[model samples]
Target: MEEVYEFLKNAKTWYLATVDEEGNPQVRPFGAQNIFEGKLYIQTGLKKKVAKQMLSHPRIAITGMYQGKWIRLNADAIYDARIEAQQSMLDANPGLKHMYQAGDGNTAVFYLKNAVAEICSFTEAPEIIRF
Candidate 1:
């Protein structure tokens, strides 16, 4: 869990690769994830195309690098908008305070599917590692 937070915090930007209903890949860069109690929190516009994509195919991939060659992870994204959507985002980034108003309009969250973190590195061999 601590490792998860560290990786997410260090990531300047993450590539969210999702597949459309037609199985076409749509990759985009986004930065709005917060780590809470060993969980990763991500938010975005509900009207956005990614949101639509999630509805069709909830599976996703999130990746980042750590030590130039130590591939940080390949996460299984689980789109979750219910259960702590608003508070979790604010707690994670805190910048959302300025983005929010008297009413929380941008209140949506995505949970990592299966939510497994693997340390991907090709130092010597091919071993599937999970952190």
Candidate 2:
């Protein structure tokens, strides 16, 4: 879990894939990530289409590349309604404070559960981590 968090933190900009209402895949670049209560969490606005998609379909995938290596993660996005969870994410990513607050109705934080991530590079065998 720590390894995955480090890789994603360093990667800085990962892509999150969600399924739309029509069953089509939607992918977007995301930068917010953190570990809280031993779970990997991501931040977004509740009003965003991505959040709506995730609410309807919890299964999602994330992919990011850094330094010639890339990570592909599949997980269930569980929304955490607790303020502490929101605060933790905002604390980790201060820039989000400009647009989000812990108790703001628009702010949404989700923890990734049953996650399996594969880190791959052409020069080396893939490393798989589960959390």
Residues 11-118, model 1: lDDT tens digits: 767667778878999988866777654566677666678877876787777766656533334545555545565576766677766765223544567666465556
All candidates: TM-score:
0.73, 0.99
Best by TM-score: 2
Candidate lDDT (C-alpha), each: 0.63, 0.96
In model 2, which runs have C-alpha deviations exceeding 4 angstroms? none
Per-model root-mean-square deviation over C-alphas: 3.2, 0.5
- Give per-residue CA lDDT, model 2, range 31-123, as digits (tens): 999999999999999999999999999999999999999999999999999999999999999999999999989999999999999999999
**CA lDDT for candidate 1:** 0.63
Candidate 2: Cα lDDT at 76: 99
